[model samples]
Target: MRLTSGVFMFLLLVLSSVCVAETYNMETQFIAPIKLPINLVPLVNEHLDSPFERYGCAASLRQSLEASFVRLSPTAEPSILVKPAESCLCGVHTCSFWILRQCGATYCFAGHLHAHSIEINQATLLNDYYGLTGLPGGATSSEATHFLFDGKSYVEEKIEPKQIK
Candidate 1:
């Protein structure tokens, strides 16, 4: 049977949306020594001109976390909190935030400045209770944006990190 383009598109969309794997929202604890990967790239907005530069911070953090996880256990699934902290900001230089991850339940930490890491009020889950998948928002191929999560999910949550300009 020949299906019209509009109908076919609608059906495909519905099926795809329905096929999304169900994720659990149950309260879970992080395994010991929650590791946060250190970002090796500069966090200046001007330096984010290329893909490598753009995703360097997040990708480096993920790679570091993965490496630590591999060393600890290749089979164990652990929850992680990736906190991006501003490390340096000068007159002309853009701000740079160092990324750190910890293993445990979410805890309140204060931001710092002057030769120290300032933890931002952002806690991103790395993996789930099961060793299956990482966080839902992966990097995208946008212009200069390194990481862009699902807009729909962010919209639903109504919480998007704002630039500290």
Candidate 2:
């Protein structure tokens, strides 16, 4: 129930394109263009849910969560990542997570990207340096992020806060 590497890798390209409008003082037109994996596009065009549909994909809910789990998860071995969407709208899907094995320990990550059926509102999306946004009911309106534990030490990082140009 997870997106394949090609699928997520394509999303990464999109993520890479979306440079925060604030830091760069760029226009919205420059936001990362959505180029989901071509092979998976058909399923999405048909409005079908990918394997990432089940869990909330909630940043916290996913296994050893990681944004790139859908693509680069297996390489890590004993790691995990959680998907997004604790309460998805389509009942089809919203987000995903991944975990991989690290040196003698497990590293978990929570990712929310490459959503297939989830409707997106680019204008409302937090166009910050980190390309993250918060939501209501505990979801941040700027960036969806939180502290994660490596099962040994806690990694301190969050989506960069959005700032005005």
Candidate 3:
């Protein structure tokens, strides 16, 4: 009887852990761009070109950047979503956003977009990555652009028109 109870306890513990793991949801939470990881700095420098030269932002790249961590899948590594913070990195409506995913020891660009806001849809996925909706002018915007991973990168799938009240 003691052995049976022990086995039942072990099963209960394992089932509870599995349920917790399956219910984990990844949400985007934006935060101030802190000092980037040493491995990520070079990728940022390469992909995130000089905003000063392009948009004439007074602040340096690191200063104008905001960041968020998101895991595309329950089993996948978390990816960093870097976005513009200052006015210089944005247009009248939208700002640039980039996603970087770790590959082996280093990170690589997964996607890029210019949008007022972004939402990751876990229900939809392609190439083992979550689908992204880029709202160019906020939730009330007339249209939202959908992007899906194309094995190599995220590409625009369609422009969905939204009904405005």
Candidate 4:
């Protein structure tokens, strides 16, 4: 009976490791402060409110992404692979992707500011970035919810990632 119990315990340990899901580090960048179009200025003025109001674009984006991530991944512990900096401007858009790769991230949450809106998208990191497709095991749509700032709060929208195949 003792030998049987030991075998069962060993099997449980091995199975538990296999069942554990991979944890991803979350990183967000505002890219830059948005310049709204003339027509949309009024609409955004009312809705681009953020908790880190005093912080600049980069911090604000990080805060917003962190908040949303917590809501989406209630059980997962939060981790930030990228160190906080006063700025996060990579000259070219593609340069930012290189930064993420260097940081050793399995996932990244990014927010970009546009003429009339703030867009948020999450992507997986592997050989390349994949949007909603090729997610790690056990990932769900909630974890990859594409959102847009609607002048009041983030609203779920279907925004496709550029690098997604």
Return the top candidate by lDDT.
Answer: 3
The residue ranges of model 3 lying beyond 4 angstroms of the native Cα positions read 1-34, 48-59, 138-142, 159-165
Per-residue lDDT tens digits for candidate 3, residues 1-165, read 999999999999997765441111112235434444655645666665454524455445565555667777556788887776565566667667778887777778887776777877777867788888776664555576778988777899965565799
lDDT tens readout by residue for model 4, 1-165: 999999999999998876554322223433332222243222322333333322435534343122112112223333122222222322111111101111233433332221111111233222232221112223232233433333222334566666867
Kindly report which residue pairs in candidate 4 clash with one another: 47-151, 47-152
Error of 4 at 99 (Å): 7.3
For all candidates, the clash counts are 4, 46, 0, 2
> In model 4, which regions exceed 4 Å deviation?
24-80, 83-99, 103-165
- 1 versus 4: better lDDT goes to: 4
What C-alpha lDDT does candidate 3 achieve relative to the native structure? Answer: 0.66
Worst 10 residues of 3 by lDDT: 20-29
Clashing pairs in 3: none
Q: Each prediction's TM-score against the native?
A: 0.17, 0.21, 0.67, 0.25
Best by TM-score: 3
In candidate 2, which residue ranges exceed 4 Å CA deviation?
1-93, 102-156
Ranking by TM-score: 3, 4, 2, 1
- Once model 3 is optimally superposed onto the true structure by TM-score, how far is the C-alpha of residue 28 displaced, in angstroms? 12
Tally clashes: model 2.
46
